[model samples]
Target chain A: MSGASTSTAVIDPYAPFSQGKTIQLSSASPFLPRYLASTLPPHTSPSHVYNTRLRGKLLILDNPLRESRSAQLKQERAAKREAEKQRRVQGVMGRREAKRLGVWELRKEDAKWALFLPIHHLWLGYIAELLQLPPPPSDDILHSTDPSKHRLPSVPGTQAKLVKADLHGSILSVKRAKNADLVGRGGIVVHETENTFKVVTAKDELKVLPKRNSVFTLRVPVYAVRPGTGEEDGGPMWEFELYGNQVCFRSSERASRKFKFKETIEL
Target chain B: MFIDLNVPFPEPIVYESQFTPSKKKQKQKPAGLTNAHASTSAMAVVPAHPLERLRVPDRKALRERVEMLIHLGYTIIAFTQSVQSKLDPAAPVNWFDGGEGTVFRDLDPRFNGGKRGVVQLRRLNVVLDEASEKGFGFNAQTTQLLAGYDILSLTPLTTSTFQSACLQHSLPSSSTIHLITAPLLPSPRLPYYMKHTLVRTALKNGARFEICYAGVFGDGARNWWANAREVVRAAAGGRRDGHEGVIFSGGAGRVEHLRAPGDVMNLGTTLGLPHETCHAAISRIPKSLIIRAETRRTYRAILSEPKLVFSAVPAGAAEDGGEQREDGKGVKGLMEILNEEEERSRKRVLEADDAGEGQEGDGEESEPSGRKRRKRRRKNR
Candidate 1:
């Protein structure tokens, strides 16, 4: 009995305080289990205090919990790195596909050509570029008018000028044509021959319109010098209705012909 | 400006008398040549028929139809042809050949004369039916070919197709996809798949929902009305969620199918759309669509500002050094000059008003007191 008591006392330092009592004072303490469990090594079994006491001393220097937490962090970082690589690869592939499908080319070309041009003038630039012709001269003089001067006719002899001037690059709108085909169409003059004028329509279709029997109203932006003022007069753009049947000469030949300007008298 | 975005090309008219013998007999009777013996004798006298009788009246009919739309105050009309397959890309496209003495010549006789409002032509919607996977499969080549068209629309058969299209197109990145909302026959209500959430996503992607009103004029008026009501409900939801991507258009095939801007607006109101939104659906929304289409087709065309061309200055102005000042000038000069001129005019008007007030004070001193007394009486009452 004395040897057994001595061994118990050596193994447990608090054995002398808890003799034969069923309810010991140390068992009721809140800090005992929590502190022991926290002090125990992560790899050791947590349920039995006897096993922990046996193995806890050997594992005291080794922090298995900290090692496990670090390993888990490394695994998470690798997954994140993999996801980032995948995203980058996807981005590159998308760009390549866009280029292959001409989407990139379209966007780039559009940006390069349309960067400096205005929207309303897009048609003019488009037709000019397509037909390999210079765009129509800007209407600086006509648009430079004060509100009061806007009501006055900017170009007094527009009808006469239209009949005599070169009709290249002029915007033509069909007013009245004996042929039903030339009634409501409008386009920019691409090429003018003796009998027919090639025009690029708004839809970008090239059409050869015969210059016979069609009544065309041309919107020619003209700069008119004010009489006696010696200053450039800013006026509204001029629209003149001319009978195509009257002018049968080529655009180049029209400049030399002294044709009578017969303006359509609107009833 | 009102825009009728979908008008199918009219079929060539075939004269009934040319096909049926019964109609020929009726025509002969009307001409007082019912007697078979007399008719035979007349036919022998003039073996060659008159040129007028041989002429086709289809051109006249088409012209009249376009004119009727113009008279009804539609400033723009898009003649849409639905694209069915890859083999027929140009099938739905109709190039108005008015300039080349084709059938469309008389369609807008006064268009260029500056006598009426401008009637701009556009190819509105190119419908892609993604119902048949084999026939209407999304082909990259076809999409590229359709780039020539202004607006491209997709009509998905199933909800999954709609979602897939939205996912693939990335509607927010490109404003190319136009959602067509036509009446669903037999079942007028919105399909279960067309959920509010899906519509919200589409709206977020910059996809516009189109409401074609031509279906209202035909036998499917009831169905169309029901469909339109559901669309309005969806639009209302979108509006509440701070999105406005709805557009109203006339998908008119014939002249009788066309409606005035006011009438269409009234129809929109009946469909539960707000007054302002209804007006915008026809005018502002369609205008933006046209601009988007134009930009899509023309690479060199930008929609930022109006393009200006520099006309040769007058010799006199050139000498005055005004031309030099505007040599490298852009939109800035034009806008600044106009604004300065407007400010000067406004100041002059104010000065005139001050002078007029002085004159009025001298002319009528008693009238001013009477006016003040009347004002005091109104205020007291």
Candidate 2:
């Protein structure tokens, strides 16, 4: 008992403070046996501390007898997702800006922006379906003529529907702007306000660009993106410009806005 | 695409006399003389500005002709108004602005009936006779006047007019003259010879020659055969495709003049156009002309429409190569976080397997947190 080295960490169970209580081999803290290290504020995880002093004795980190914290976190996330889905079905989208989503504000992305590519694809399909453009240009010409001349753009009757199409998730670049900083900024539209767009650029930047005095180069694939399959049906890319000043309306208000071909007098 | 680009719209009755005829009658045998003859005989009579205001009888006749075309299975029909009087270039060009609606007001533009609907098209045929050779009002300022027309056809009555119509007015860059029809009704032969160079130049510039089958049944039946054969021979020699750029339309005035498309194609064969080429003239050739003519309103006669779309690659990677150099602190990227999450999940999965023996007996109640619950129960028991 007396030959123990002076430098040795000989924690005594019978010491006055440790008597009738569990040994304090690990540093005392409010949140550890819970191992909720990730739950703490970022950069505040107790990494410098011996991650767990009782890691060997208590076997909490690796033992089969106790539950894994990671599995517990997965359960919590799954539950949250289910609740979100229920809220969506009930028409309780957490915000009025988006028509069909709950607690689903898609403003910025520090990560997971690539995940939005699929959403962008769905937007392309939505437009193609709304426009009802002809079957994407084929390498083979249409040998079988319908012998009908009134297939003017296939159906001129659908012009009204095309004028009021919804433009969510469209990829656009600022072509002209009053402010030079706003020019050349292009992105997938994450959210649209009455007079602005919350865009997540390819650099994963969320820019809230003003709509007035700007011309946006909207890029669209000629063909529709097939749903559920992440591949395109192969068509050339086409670009057209939309005057931002003309489109300064909330997404809901845009459907009711009347568009005309009258020449603009302003430069 | 069975198209009849020229179903002659009825001449509007201008009650005001064009040239009083000096009120001096010869008292000769002919009791029925049309107003046009009196004006032409007066010598000093200036050509009337082709009347546009329609009376009831005139509208009724036009409606009847359009219905006849629809009944005869002509899918697309142009109510062609032949403007014989030269237009004053300085005057307002919207003369035929709402002519189609005025003529077919009660009828729907897409008035569907037997087989399919008759799509109404308004055509403006400017007759370039010797009297108006200086300018038939074809110029930059006349686009407003031509905007109302779905097709612009030219009728060259003189050799000078024919040369201008073929070489100058047929250019795809600036001109809108889609069809060139020589006035074969009164003329013995085309005022100008159908030279191969002129024919090829016009054809190259996307001008189509129209062979009016209605002329064959008119007073000029004899003249129609001679003029049409020359046109077909010259236009066919211009292009490799024997009957390449010739379309058959009816410059029919009376109801009886309108013939079925099959009969018209048969009439084309009479002009020595092959049976296949004749079928194409009424079907394929005219259909293409209609599409070309529709381009007059576009930005620059562009065929494929342009629209906006997303690029295949990410815009940052496409435009700039410095995506990774976006300035910031030691920011955790997406891949790093994702990999860490995956590692933790794998660890949890392994732990579940190790604890599988303890929970296997009554594994049916297995919640992910069941292991902790079971351990607590053992301690209590």
Candidate 2, residue A70: the lDDT equals 96
Residue range with the least summed lDDT across 10 consecutive positions in model 1 chain B: B298-307
Cα lDDT of model 1 by residue, B261-280, tens digit? 88898888888776777888
CAPRI grade, predicted model 2: incorrect
Cα RMSD for candidates in order: 23.5, 33.3
Tens-digit lDDT track of model 2 for B306-330: 4322235533224331232222323
Give the per-residue lDDT of model 2 (tens digit) for A158-193. 334534566667776765465756767877787788
Q: Could you tell me the fnat of model 1? A: 0.00
The C-alpha stretches of model 2 lying farther than 4 A from their native spots are A1-267, B13-52, B90-95, B99-116, B237-239, B303-381
The interface root mean square deviation of candidate 2 comes to 10.4
Top-scoring candidate (lDDT)? 2
Poorest 10 consecutive residues by lDDT, candidate 2 chain B? B329-338
Candidate 2 residue A263 C-alpha distance from true site, Å: 25
> TM-score for all predictions?
0.40, 0.45
Clashing pairs in 1: A138-B309, A138-B310, A138-B311, A180-B105, A181-B101, A181-B105, B171-B205, B172-B205
The candidate that achieves the highest DockQ relative to the unseen native structure: 2
